[model samples]
Target: MSGIPDNLVGLHKHVKQFREKNDETLFEELELFIEEEKVRRKLVLERPGELFFFYKEDYIVVTEELSKIPLTAEEFTGSSSLLRQLNEDQIDMVGQLTKELVILRSMRMWGSYLSC
Candidate 1:
């Protein structure tokens, strides 16, 4: 029942690669770094492959007539007005979880923590 962002796997790999490539130098591909970051954010904003804000519909029941059952964005695009409402902290929360999951995966200790 855990909620892992659909783009999390890519974020994990991207961050890991970015770390490995960083040389801590003045000319350390700053533009490339920025582009990578934008790509990461775009994944969330655009929600390619139905990314982020994961949910399960079968678990819910329609007790009565209502409007919004399963929540959804007004649009799924890099320039989505609704998706853009997510604040920096909210985005960072997912990023941080992705980082931690990456660490756990690297440790190969999934014997009990998680199944997926």
Candidate 2:
């Protein structure tokens, strides 16, 4: 039936190709981490530095907030070089952390207002 994810191909909703490189790719990846109603799964979020996220739910919230910003190599290249090799899952986790850092670093002057 609906077991295979690729089987969703017949649906009318727009399907995006990864090649175009747009918000859809980010949203699609974000959607994969969120579980609703009948389908629940574990989410794993990683720490790139001093930040700490105790629960998996943090990934859903963090990813949504982080996606609002775009990626830049000038900000990420240094920190990302911490690892020489990353498997797919590690790449995702590290990328998420890097994005989070970029946003927070960019918002640094906002100070305590970040909580608001």
Quantify all predictions' global Cα lDDT against the true fold: 0.35, 0.38
lDDT of 2 by residue, 3-116 (tens): 235644443355455344555565575465444312322322233333332222332234444443433444346434332232222543433544233244345442432342
Residue 35 error, candidate 2, Å: 9.3
C-alpha-based local distance difference test score of model 1: 0.35
Off by over 4 Å in 1: 1-24, 48-96, 100-116
lDDT of 2 at 85: 31
| Deviation from truth (RMSD, Å), model 2 | 15.9
- Cα deviation at 64, candidate 1, in Å, is 26
Q: Ten-residue segment with the worst summed lDDT in candidate 1?
A: 53-62
Clashes of 1: 0
